[model samples]
Target: MSLNPLRLASKALIALFCLSVLTGSVRPTQLEVVRMQGEITMVTRNSPTTFYEDRSGPTGYELELAQAFADHLGVQLRVVVADSLSDIFRLIDTQPGVFAAASLTRTPQRERLVRFAEPYQQISEYVIYRRGGLKPATPADLLQGRLMVTAASSHSERLHDWQASNVPELSWSESPELEVADLLQMVAQGSLDFTLVDSNEYRMLQAYYPTLDIAFNAADQRDIAWAFGWSRDDSLHQAANDFFAHIKPQPLLANLAERYYGHLDKLDYVGARRFLRQADQKLDTYRPHFVDAAGEHGFDWRLLAAMGYQESHWNPRARSFTGVRGLMMLTLNTAKELGVKNRLDPVQSIHGGSLYLSRLRDRLSDVPEPDRTWLALAAYNVGFGHLTDARKITAQMGGNPDLWLDVKEALPLLSQKRYYRHTRHGYARGQEPVDYVQNIRRYYDVLVWNDEQTQPLKGEELLASSAITVVPPLL
Candidate 1:
């Protein structure tokens, strides 16, 4: 009954082959494998809106949104940083094997190659100029020619469109290496006569450089959205649409808009003049407080001085109708919370304010860094509950909860019930914090510059102080 050796060997090989086929049948297909794992690969650019570093850590609008999306999908997010817009496109087109979304501009040209998610925000283009420079009223005025912009930007696209349609003879060189902030800096320094920027960016920059003016608006608006690779995965596309559909613009966004842009139009000439003169005289007296408080809280002393200026104009006896009193303007509750018995005591007031700010910052540990700082500033002015509501509104509006820009936009919405009741903090006057932060930032910058200008020339040798150290006013 036994078979020959060769025949038996052939039978064994066939059985082994059959067993292999049985095992292979249970393995998953590529699509099923990816779906089961649920990991999303997102591509983003390194910029203030997309991603950047601050005193805290990684932050930006796109970064927060990407993280949110990953959380929604119940997976880990892998962000691939692209060096340029062109690089982002190339990565999406060629590495279709990996990336799920590219937070990019929703342009006709881009739409032709990739599918775009619903528009999350709209960006208006504008021309930036120095306060006393020749302001261009129209595209034709630009033909007189002193304008520059970053290369490969939406601003460049708008400028090109302007040239092709209205000002055919206008010409300018592109500074490819310059970011929008750098371009604004060039305009501020009068190195460049004009530059183009998204209106939101223009507002933020203007808060810092009040002397910079918007010469004119561009002819068109750019809708910004997430770009997805051309795929048959209609489910992912539909999910994105659903998320955006539920997202509504809230008052917080409005407050942020006002915080950054509103006061720019109202220059506060008298208050500014008073602040300038007083700051020059008293900055030294409070210098030690800044040094001490900044050391304990890990903040710039100049920033502390700036905050004091914004809060109480550095007046030891400053008092607000709202019951905020002292040089740092601590409310009765805030002063009590920080263990300060006298709100008017300069040392206690500064220490209490710094402690309060530090606590606000710690409350937002879930938020990313620069944003954490920005949100803390908002909380410092408006209170923590209001800030939390703004973050919620930011999320509800399809914006990043961890981004200052997004939260800023959401803050003002607290005044409206249609949006505020859904928040934990109920209702608040969100605009105050936006204005408070912007003013402090402006005052701080001027103070820093003033300090640097006077440091060496007065023959006063200042030591290289640690993160904290206050100096007496020389003048």
Candidate 2:
């Protein structure tokens, strides 16, 4: 009864084998899947928006949705991270109780093959091209060739519809082996003149690949929904529908969307490009200091490094016009409180900053993480007092004070005299902290991506520890 996933899966396999022989049929029904496997075997492709590996294991928008559905079914979530759209559909087609939550657009062709749950989100398809390149003015212009898209994608359907009459010569190659990110990269490099991507995918990747511009809208807005095997019995389909009905109007959807795409628009093409370049140039110099501080404070060294970049762009000698100085950009009073004597010392600055952040995080012991860590970052920028006032406002406005998503919405109201006048900490510039936390999160994501793809740099190698501790940094 208290078995782990491996044991449960093993028992499920054995039970399924027995059932196949007993029923004299190998094909499992929805009820059979639920009875045999103690988990929801959901199918999806690996992408930023669909499903992908991270430090915490597999995570993404669709994965979260699938996990919720599994919980609703009172079972575990077993994600099948497929390589292509076709593979995703195939799993749903062949496996009982299997479903695809890869942010699939509910197209007519797909609707004919599999049943779709109630639509959850809507998206539009667009033809994308490199900025300043030969942009396609219409389907005919695109028909000249150099078009690429993922095989069996909604984009291909749009192309087929166009080629049927509008541009009978229109042709686009589908790379069954490649993902949307790969195709977008090709368009960015000018290897392909055109490709189609959903708006959500573009929003998630725009910060990273800013040069890829939208050429034209290729299709009308479409609904995204989960896919189940087409069957006369609608048990799983009905269950999925009930799950959607419950979450569609709740804060969960908004919060989840914010978690992934909230900071996407924070950085522009030039800003992101600049950050990546300096991530190599200036960050390496102060990398050791941040690493030492991070080791002592128990934080991701890159997170600390990203904070340093955000604070002062890793410039040890950099001074803000507001009298904040050095790599960590600490004020004299705050630096003194953190036992930082020389605010300009790069190593001391990072250590002081880390300690100050730790102290702020410590004060928020009652708050749950991620929000707790984010609130600490906000407090670090403005003041803890102002953050409290904003939290109070969040509660007064019927928003959850403990959730960063809700608190952030209330934060900007601090600038209004009508709102901040009654609070103890009055008229604080709240937007600064929002930008601060979001930017660092973006930078940290980039750093993590780089580390996963390449090797991570350990600050211990560049500089020996003088006296720092090994406490994990604040979240």
Candidate 3:
């Protein structure tokens, strides 16, 4: 077949144009995909599972995992915190171009919208009830009355599905302002009959609210995974899969899990509330002592105040069952070591406490900054030997020894001979220090915020003139 030259040339050009379009759409190779050149944006929630600010800085299970993943890829990790799960999904759905990973759960509905990596962790939903409430043994029992669940949560979805099929009469109310913790609180206080929560969250909360009972576990378990935008970019997907494959074997990942989920105790709300109220009153009187101590020790006064409130509610006459006494609760040995004649003297107590805490911090100089501070606080409550024992246990259990979260898990094990038998500090009250440090951190934050709200600015003329260097005696 013979064709004219012009027609042949036109057909050839068309074929070439089609080929160029195909080539342009082709995905880049893993090696050629700008290796270690771009920032890896990881989207996560502010919940404990994802990211949150602690005394040290930003931390959480997902936060650490994402950071480690970024390091493995040789890219700087930029975390994007979302206020809610819906917001996270919206961001991933709309701005597919921005994020590299979304630390979220893998569900059938979400799978249709985004690609998910291999499962990282397994989680289940549960019904939390007050200690004396009727326990719901099954779905049938839950249908007997009104129930509460977080808005737009997997709990709601599961309940909705169950109602539609198994229990036609089942109905539930939703709380928009409440988190799982709040729901658990309501249940614990007997305000609500029941509420649903994630099983992992329930475990963590159980440590604080030990009396709260789990009515039942959800019928199915949810697998949590990292999500990516729906695209044919198999290279990126393949890279993610490869990265996750390495994560499980790494001691750091296990450590991250233990840090956030392990070493939790059920909190006595009645006792905690009473303690908090008394601490509030005492904070006003001890404010000056904290300021002086902060100056003497080169630490944040608010932090010292927080520590005191946590230790003894800032009560100068406070005494613990373990023989820790005074405003900052100095033990006899610690007071003697700090050259304090009397632990009951508020000024001496504060100064001694600051000195002891500073020494603990200084002793851990090799540890990273924020972690060093956390370990010091833990040691201040427990003892250095016990803290070291916990760290060793954390390392042995495939956790990061340098991380406070991991060490916190190990702290509790110090009370258990199964793990602590080999430690230099044999049989210590590991749980006390964990609770002590956490409560102190929470109280310290509250006091700092409250002080900021009431006190005048540092440089204000009246404030400066009225601010006596020495705290006046309480009237």
lDDT of 1: 0.69
Model 2, span 1-475: residue lDDT tens: 4769998899999998998899899565575578467877888887888888875577898888788888878888887778778888888888877888998999999899899999888888888888888888788898554776777888877777787766766665666766676677667766677889999888887766768788888768999999999887778889899988888778878877888888777788798889888886777777777778878877788888888889988887889889999888999999888888898889899999999888898999899876888899899999999999999999999999888899899899999999999899899888889999999888887777666655422323211322211211112
User: Global lDDT of each model?
Assistant: 0.69, 0.82, 0.71
TM-score of every candidate relative to the true structure: 0.64, 0.87, 0.69
Report how far residue 186 has shifted in candidate 1, in Å: 1.0
Rate residue 278 of model 2 by lDDT.
88
Best by TM-score: 2
**Residue 29 in candidate 1 has what lDDT?**
38
For model 3, where is the 10-residue window of minimal lDDT? 466-475
Task: Report model 3's TM-score to 2 decimal places.
Answer: 0.69
Give candidate 3 regions above 4 Å deviation. Answer: 1-25, 29-37, 54-58, 97-103, 130-137, 143-148, 173-193, 203-213, 266-288, 291-315, 318-324, 331-333, 336-341, 377-475
Model 2: worst 10 consecutive residues (lDDT sum): 465-474
Candidate 1 vs. truth: CA RMSD?
Answer: 11.7
